[model samples]
Every structure is written in C-alpha cells, then in structure tokens.
Target chain A: MNIERYDRQTILKEFGMEAQLKLQAAKVLVVGAGGLGVPVLTYLNAMGVGTLGIVDNDMVSLSNLHRQVLYSETDVNKSKVVTAAQKLKEQNSETDIISLETYLTPENALRIIADYDMVIDASDNFPTRYLVNDACVILNKPFVYGALHSFEGQVSVFNFEGGPTYRCLFPEMPKADEVPNCNENGVLGIVPGIIGNFQALEAVKMITGIGEVLNGKLLLFDGLFNSFQKIRFSLNPENSKIKALQDSYDFNCEVSVNSITSDDFLQLLAENEIQLIDVRTPKEFEKNSMSFAKNIPLSQLEERQDEIIFEVPVYLVCQSGVRSKKAVNKLKEARANAELINVDGGMNEILKHAIKY
Target chain B: MEILLFGIAKDIVGRSSFRFEEGDEVPKSVLELKQKLNNSFPDFGKLSSLAIAVNSEYAQDGKSLQRGDEIAVIPPVSGG
Candidate 1:
C-alpha cells in the first residue's frame, strides 16, 4: 500500500492507521455505473479501498453524461462497466477494479456478490434493488442502498450487523409504472452525486468502524428544500428468513401483457389494418409517429378508453417499450377481455427498419 | 397534523407538506391517512409499496396518530 497516498484521511486522530488499513482490506461491489456508482467507485478508489467491482450492462448514452461524470462525450455508446473500470484504474492504479459487464439477474446475483464482502445497490431500477437486497440477505452480506427521485434521494445501509433490510422499509417492489425512473421522470445532475457520496461515507464507516453507520435508519435528502430527514425503521424477521431468490424479479411480471417485435408488427401492419395507439406524450408523438397510429398519451388513457377499439387487438407504442407495457396493463384493468399487445422496443426499434410515417 | 410527502408521493400530492388544522377530521391511524391520500389522489392507491413514518420512525398501518404528530409518506424510488 502507498502510505503517502492515504496520509490525509489517515492523519485524522479518530480514523488513524487502523481505519486506513481496514479500507485497504475491504472488498466492495457496486452494482451500477450510471449515476450513483460513479461517485461511489470514484471515492472508494481514490480513498485507497483495496478491491472494487462494477456490474452494469448499459452503454454510456448522450443523456448519461450529465450525472455520470466519469464518462465524457467521447465515451458515449461504450459499455459503462468497461469505461468506468478504465477511468477508475487511471484515478488509482493501486485499487483492483473488476468490471463485470452484465446485469445482476437472479441466476448471477448470488455468484457475483459472493466474491465481495459488501455490495452497493446503486442500480436505477426496482428489480435490481430488490434482487440486491434479497441476495445480500441470503449471503449474509451488508449493502449500501441509494436511490433517487427527481430532486429527492434516499440512502440506507441494509443487512449490516443484523440491521433492517430494504424489505423492512418498503415491503414489496413497487409495480411497474407506479414510480417513474430517472430516465422517465428526470433528476438533477447533482442529486445522485450528493446521495452517492453519502453511500460511500456509510460504506467507509461500516468498513473502518468510524462514525455510526446508517443501519436501520434511512437518510432522505431533498435538494429542492435543502433538507435531510432520517427515518428510523426496525428489521422484520420475516425479511431475513429468505432462503432463496424469487423465481422472477422482473417488474412487469405481475401483468402478463403479450408483445410483438417491431418488425413483426410492421409485417402485420402491411397485411392488415391494425389498431395501434401511440402512448407517448403529444410532443413526442408530434415529433415522429406512424400515420396509422392514434395518439393517446398514457396520462389520458383512462378517459380515452372509448377511442381505442376493444373488438380487435390494440397495439401500444411509446418512445421505449416501457410505457407501452404500462398502457397494456392499464387497458387490461378497464377491459379485462381486450386483446392488447405492446410493440416491443417501441418506436426506437421501428425506426431501424424502412417504414413510412 | 402535518403530513410530509417524499418521492412519488410528493409528486402525487403536488406539495412537499400539508396540514390538517385543529378542528379538521385528521386521519387517526396510518391506514386511514393512506386511505385519505388515496381518496384524494388516486395515484397514491396505485403505488404498490409505500412507507409511513410517524415522528421520524417507521409506522405500521395500525399505528395510531395524534394531532401534533408529524407523518411522512414515502414511496419506493427506483432511480440511481
């Protein structure tokens, strides 16, 4: 270890050489390289954490450059894990950075997490959050949890020394479309930086025995108000009794909506006049939409059910396939027997093929 | 009683915090508070998971409330 590199943090009387040594010996895994994972990995590596692992299957898009400061304009369209690992290595070569270019699924979560001492739930989706919680609980490992919603952010330490788990705070994963993600809702670039730093601080505290960790207490920060609130919670014994992973962590598992590929939908469109509903906002629909599709924003789906023909299969399309699936689910509730099919990949996929607007 | 909203709950309510004044028929329990919010804003009912905190501590549905108690409605956030 380079003793001079960590002299500043080690010089503190409370966090002396012992704490530095603990941070050097700790092995932590961060499960996303987008917003929260960037700061967590950056700080942990710069502070001389021994081993760090990054898991993500997403590519650095133009939109990610705001909060994901690790990636630049040149890094767009590149794999997030690979780019993050390379950048982190340049920041601190002494820290062993392991890059796992895959999403944490039920099958691979346990095996991947078992190699690390601690996990950080920095993912941007509820499925991965719940998967991380369950996997950490089953493996008897502690995880630093951080999530964001627009200007608000949440940070918590779960399964730390028998403390409360994420399930204890919010029992079930919120259904798809219940809460919009950053991609859908939007987040201030600085919000995740603030929250991720808190997560890194908690991880260091837990590893080095510094200040009190946030176990059983959820720290909520509202940037708009410039306020912080800590909600105290207790562990539900039932949450810790998980012997195995659930069969599926997919958010859309609850609603079994049939789907068709954009290519197949186009082929069907040529053969027959299909009833397609574009569920994107008016602005999005006006920007680009198929001539045959009807514009019905998801926000107004409930009131405009009469416009959609329930006699034949209704095809739903959005910017991405997410909102289309949500539309299918919503329509299913109103007309249970209605045949609804979500256009997979939505307009993004359809645009790849030759088609007339 | 003052109710604070976080995450999607804040968006659904359109304000960070609100109050039920002295003579108002405030919710007596966490469950009633949720029901009231759901009744006013149907979006609250759509959220599959929500956490209520009384005096900055997690409160179950049956947890009783008082006039001066501070309540927070927190829904799960799925952003990084």
Candidate 2:
C-alpha cells in the first residue's frame, strides 16, 4: 500500500513491513481535533494509517492556535474537522482523512464508530467520552482513551483484547466543577501535545501490534513533574453494564427526576424550602461559589447517609449539571424516602440568569 | 500511612503526600482514610469518583491499611 513511505519504521525488526501493511489497512476514527486529535492525526497519517475519520463540531478560534498547531490565524473560525482533514491530507497524501464536521452525538456515534476499526477519544468533555465508550462497547471496537487537565493527562486502551473499559477504571463521573478543563483551569500548551503524542503511539501500536498497548493499564502524565505512572486496572463486570447508548450523561435516566429550573432553585433557596448541596469539591467551592450552598463534595456524600431530612428536598448541583444528576441518582438509590432533585446547567446556569431543569 | 496524591487529587489534598499515622484519630481502612482526608480538605470530598491505591495496586474501600502502607489517591482527569 504505502510500504516505501513507512520504510523507516518497517525496517525495524519488531515493526517490519508486516506491521506497516497492517497500519496501511487499519481504519481509525478520532473523535476530536482540538489539542489531542491534532497531533494524533498528524502522527497516524505520518505512519500511513489508511483510513482516518475526524469528528468535530467546533470552529478554530485564536485560542486554539497555542496547542492546535495544525491551524493558523487565517484558519481561525473555520471548521476544525475540515481544517484538520485538509492539513493532514497535505501532510500525507497516502493517508485518507475523512472530515465529519459535527459533534459526536449519541444518535450518530454508533454509525460513525462502526465504520472504523478503532476509535481514539480526544474529546475535552465527559458527555462525548461516555458516549464514545458506550458506542465502542456496543460496536465491540477497541478505543484509545486520552484525557488531560492542566498539567496532568491520562492515556489508556479500552475494550481491546477483552481488557477493561473506561467505565471499569472510572466508575463514576466527577462533577463538572471538580474537573479543571483546559479552558478554565488553563493547560500548558505542551501538556496535550505530549498526551496526544502518546495517543498516536497507542493507536499505531494497536494497529500494527508493534508494542505493548496500554490495555487494562491507566497511564498518568504529570507535565509539571515530568512523571508518568502506569497503573494496572482489573476488569469490573459491574461497571461494564452498558446495554445501550444513554440520551444524557445523567446515568441513563429516562426522565429527569425532580429537576427544577434555576429560578425555582433560587426561590427554594430563598424560601428555605429546599437544601442546596454543591456536589463540587471544596477547592471549586472556594473559587466564587454560591454562598447559600452547602459544601458536601460528592465523594463524602456517603457520610451524609444519616444527615438527610426526608421532608426537605435536597437539590444537587455541579458545573455543567452532569455530576449533580449523578448525585441525584445516588441519593435516590440509597435513600428511598429522601427527595433528591437536580438543578440543571449547574453553576453555568447559576452564572447565567437563564436555567433549565 | 503516608498518602500520595496524583492529578486532581494533588489539587484537593494541597500536597503531593501526607502522613496519616494509625491511631484513634487516624483511619484503618481505605474508606476511613478517604473520609479523614475529606474532612481535612473538603476538596477531597469532590473526588467521590477517585480510586485508591495501596502500595502499588488498587485497593477497595473495604481494604484495611497497615501503619506503613504506602497510599496514593488517584483522580480521573479530563482536559484534552
């Protein structure tokens, strides 16, 4: 296919022409083109990975240039996937880069992921992460998991060769507030570049079977400390129970349970009819938090087993409201008599006047 | 127990590692150790989703910790 182009890697004893041939036949779908996807696609193309699909709904901004090196000032405000595909095509004419200019929604995840041999999770948010995991789980495709925050990042391979999945390692999703996204918490430009390079390596390893892919092992990279920790994780059958793709990241709730608008949430807070529990961590709480809210981080919610007053409804909230919805589920399962509700949009809405249940 | 922290766990604990000497005031189990940390640093409570590692392997909440057990708090990260 492209043996001559990959001769440098093909010459290696471990990664000979056989591995190069496998890489040429491999079809990979990368779910984001922000920071991680950019380098991942670049390296994969350089390695001559045959079929590459890119999914992204975001447009490049001036802010994207620091880390997303593929885009330029002229490319600002243009579609990320489109720009990525064009750049990658120019960089490697042998690799076919297909650009899908849309967000990876649950409705479209399976169809897109099914068309690929494997998926690389380069998304920046939790919803897409969970969606991609479930889609790959259903499709029975191996996925390279990559996530980063500020100076730290994690790389792992899930569902490959019957190893553990992302849900196996992370049973619960952290509240959005607890997560230090690159946008708010701020990440060094090199953080994702390093992590993305690892992801590309993992994909190449998976495709060519050249090296030991990080299956069942979670690799954490702390850019600040320049340290890497590879932690092994056992398969958790209980956590791998994904029968279908979920509509929301709210723990597969079919209906929003006792969800209240921000107006009603504040009104209840003012009237003292409802108790507001910010499920975000105390560090997040200290950073411009709602004064009326109580600081009960989700991790310590188990200690609040006896503190629940069944009569007063407890409203749970986090950054984007995904974690609060999870808190609501946990409370509902543990305390049947307790009335637990979720405040939609979490602090994002609290910051903005408009809110939804 | 000198508990080590990684990723967002470090942000919550404020330090990379802290000692939790076994005693009446100290914790004997992983769950208890987490509760103690949560009390000291309320941010630890936010990481309800974190996994604990004793020595090198992952330990369950029910796993008991000895006096010299090396502990590390692991937090899930999402950025890229």
Q: Tell me, by TM-score, which candidate is best.
A: 1
Candidate 2 residue spans exceeding 4 A from truth: A250-357, B21-26
lDDT of 1 by residue, A1-357 (tens): 989988998899999999999998999999999899999999999998999999997777677889999999998767889999999999999998999999899999999999999999999988899999999999999999999999999999999999999999989888777888887688999999999999999999999988899999999999998999999999999999999999889768767779999889888888898899999888678867999889999989999999999998899999768889989988998899999999987886686553344
**Native A-B contacts reproduced, model 2:** 0.73
lDDT of 2 by residue, A1-357 (tens): 655777888788998888888988999999999999999998898888999999987777676799998999999767788888888988889887888988898888988898999999999887688888888888889999998877788899999988889888777766555666665467788888999999999998888877699998888777877887777778887656677887766443565677887777776666575567888777677764687778787778878756656677788888667667867877888887887888987875665543222
Model 1 Cα displacement at A79 (Å)? Answer: 1.3
In model 1, the Cα lDDT at residue A55 comes to 97
Worst 10-residue lDDT window for candidate 1 chain A reads A348-357
**Candidate 1 Cα misplacement greater than 4 A, ranges:** A260-296, A302-320, A331-357
Q: Model 2: what TM-score? A: 0.76
